[model samples]
Target: MSVKLLVTTVLLLLPYVHTFSVEKRVSKLLSWSKSENEAPTILGWCEERRLQDATELQVTVSCGDSEPLEVSIPIPTDENTLARTLWPSSLAAAILLRLPASEQLVKDRHILELGCGLGLAGIVTSSSAKSCCLTDHDEEIIQLLKNQNIPNIDVSYLEWRDEDRPNDIPPSDLVIGADIAYYFYLLRPLIDTTKAMLRPDNSAFMVVGQANRESQWDLYHNVRDGCYNQLTDEREAPWNGETRMLLYQLQMFKWQVDDDIALENQELDGTIPIAVMIHTSPGLENFAFTTFDHIATKNDKEGIMMSF
Candidate 1:
């Protein structure tokens, strides 16, 4: 056969060989309703790439209890390495589908993802936005991102606590990350980078669970008080099963929250509960949110002066 055929044949055999070493499917339900005594659990498993037999990668995620919500994310099968994360960060996938479709995502929007271990959040975001760039300290993850074609992704090496800014990534309208608060040391510079990239007209957002929200909030608030923002709104919605990831349109000026708020968890009955947040200035001024039970974006007065 020709060189092309030989390469094709080799590629096809790789994922299967890699997949065989691990359990084919990961089955477990993880819970997000956590507290001080409980940290969310991660269940690891491997998913075979459809085209490559020897190249299937390992995926690990936290499965929530409720009909055992288990979904496998793409992983790298080479090097005989290990995989680790809180959940496969399906949050971006959850947030992406939640955004308003009429408000088309900007194609030229500069997007960045922190702790982009497997590049799932960045890759999935590119499917909705203009372009996405990913950063991580590990050279291994950078190499892994290079090997994968996740729609529109630009990869660069970065260390969170490092003094210098990441050269490989450029300034952007939005800086995207999922589950960055899992480590306390990474909070400051990560938020610092997001603030540096924040635009006056367009806002930014980071998708994280309640588990990591407090840490991110603290770091964000330290910078400009109300200049940084957070949004959490949840409701039942429909998806075409493109993947339960999420994306949003937001500016950071008019965000609101209160103590003793009622909280809810994922609904695993084959439909995803969606939260659409816009890191926008003044929360879209009487904005009408069409998807979440036809609820309007409720405004709050807690933001500092000139926050919007």
Candidate 2:
């Protein structure tokens, strides 16, 4: 064959070779796990997605239930763009589904998923949580999430860029996100939003793939500094091939709920009764009475009640 012919042929076959290599890697990585009868299982299937060099992976993820949840996830063609849904979300979904039966945190607890692209993880979480909300900053994504008929899951807009707590959505017992820490600018906003959305005493858990990326590390340090306690796990993933990821579980040191309650108290008028109750030792009764009198006098309140 002519050198020109050989070069052209090789060039033309490049895409095919790349595709085959990716497919082989994916197949190896996605090999079936032990059945749920014995342990947690994340059973999955894949199909080529139209108009993109990507695949749609569907998984029957089990969480100690007789029937596993069927979740559809679209892998991104380009990892650089935030417009495409990424694989970390799918991994996070699987992790949420595979929570052990002993850990009943999801049952009867309100959950929130932040940066919930396509609502994959959030939707899966809805099965276990009392109520699950799928939230993102983009309107188009929110609209796409709303089109799906997921039971016990609601779609809402939550802009991390906004410094204040988003209105209307109730506080959640657990907050979650997947592949959300890809940019430097979003670091603080993401943490702040998590703080606002969670109920008192609970922390947020976030899963991020492509752990080697510099951007992800920057976000991790920021989170470590900002959060009271942060824990991380690393594992292999099969989305784009055998990729490693870091799962971060962050706990806020102090509940913002206390601050909210203080604000609410400040807003309240003194029309309601203000009570001072103290069970004192017999010898300290006079001192307790004096303290109550001082408090009542300072407040100038008529409805102050004292209990022994």
Candidate 3:
């Protein structure tokens, strides 16, 4: 009775013992997996806190007559570069908007701001513009702009190298950029993008930059070589008692020649004719003349008017 009863009891209890051992191992495995998953969650929370700390800086910008604008800007670091901080040129651009002349250029107009890092200039301009589009290539910067929820403005992703502009960006009456031309390679693309974004008639491009930078000189030469004509002289805005900011107002050169004039010149000379037009706009007094080969003289002009 003892051996047979002991063997039966051990076999019956063996199955329950194995089941309990298996459950204990499963519980341990589940706990390990939970901890592994939570490690990343904890790390993510720490990264988020770090980001919040990096972006806690806020800037207040005051333009003429308008109320001051408060913007939350990220602290600039080596990693973030120009896309995080509100530069001094952006402040100058905001102040430029206060001028009556600059006001006329933006009032009731569709405006576009390129490379809008902290969106300071765009935010200031939005107060007067009919509508504004703030654009940058960085997704994080775009998210920053969206977080601002500024009125009368839309935020979009715009890369300088993108062949096609975003559909949401309308033909802007005034295109603005602040401290965007820091790189030599990006200058031509910036000019081309500005030209493409601006209206063919009655539109202007306003760019503000630190005047001392070599990139600014590159931008000036590029703009001069391009199809644009400078409308306003180089306006200086002093900053930090050391840096000088320059604001340039540029308009695309538009040529309108009468068919009669061309025909008469061809009939009389039997050769390709040269057209000379005179422009009489404020701050601009130069002649834009095109030879037979469509070569325009370098004489700076505002709006060209020509007749036989």
Candidate 4:
């Protein structure tokens, strides 16, 4: 929610004034086929530059369905984009690709997605589940999420770190999310809200990509111990023909007390490991909390769901 209030006041300077799904904006950027029955698209538009070199990435998300959809965006070679693409955000694409698939575990359930970059998973949940809410701090994106939703997909401006409740994710019986653990400041508030919003009878399903193993583990440890039942789900693999990195290694001690973890000084806080604090409640048996080590292996078609 760093983009909180800051972007609201500078609304006139922002390039993207309206709010909508990343897929919808990316579709406008790339002009992909708007089919009636396409899976929710994750990547809509992205421009970037690292170490002085410009980079442009566009992806069409066929999430849950995992069909590689084509995306179109200008090559970073464009002279006009040199300045704007310096630090463009890619969280929208990540949110879309990280949404979970439908199964007996999570159908017709109330779900909530945080840091909904472009409302990818939220829109999909709105379409598939009983109901869904998409939240983000930026008004522009929230505006877009609202515009894209025809009759469903509740989009709102919510800062997970804020003590104030924003009114959308409140009735969330179950929580769902991907790629939400990026910074330390954002992480604590997210967990706090999750605790406040989640119904006692519900569980949360979160997807962590193969990119950041250590960070995911830190996040896992922060919530697993007493607050949840750290179950050992069979390992899962990654898509895009890559190995699912042993991502949750640090979180292995999540079920136990993490006395070994130490906090770093302010200068290098991002690199230091963090311990998770889990607080248990009275109705423990009624709900189950755990992490699934999903080692997803893929070929040409059909995604993974290893167990029978």
- For this target, which candidate reaches the highest TM-score against the unseen true structure? 3
Q: List the residue pairs that clash in candidate 2.
A: none
lDDT of 3: 0.52
Each candidate's TM vs. the true structure? Answer: 0.51, 0.51, 0.54, 0.46
Error of 4 at 60 (Å): 5.4
Lowest-scoring 10 consecutive residues by lDDT in candidate 3? 23-32
How far in Å is the alpha carbon of 232 misplaced in model 2?
28
Best by lDDT: 3
lDDT (tens digit, per residue) of candidate 1 on 1-308: 99999999999999776655432222222322213485433221112122234333443222223121222344554444422332333443333323343133335566777777666546544655677787777677677677665567788887665668766576675555655654446655665566565554444554442222335344333432333223223331311111111212111111112222221221122211222223433322333322322121212112112111
- Evaluated against the true structure, the overall lDDT of model 4 is 0.40
lDDT for position 31 in model 2 = 16
TM-score of 3: 0.54
- Candidate 4 lDDT, 22-65, residue by residue in tens: 21121111111223374322223222112223233343444333
Residue 232 in model 1: shift from native, Å? 30
Selected candidate, larger lDDT, 1 vs 2: 2
Q: Which residue pairs overlap in candidate 3's backbone?
A: none
Which lDDT values do the candidates have, in the order given? 0.43, 0.46, 0.52, 0.40
Tens-digit lDDT string for candidate 3 (39-85): 21100000001122344444444433445455554444445556765
| Model 2 agreement with the true structure over 125-217: per-residue lDDT tens digits | 676678988888767667655665667988888788775656778887656666676565666577567656665443234433333344554
lDDT of 2 at 275: 20
Q: Model 2, residue 166: displacement in angstroms?
A: 3.1
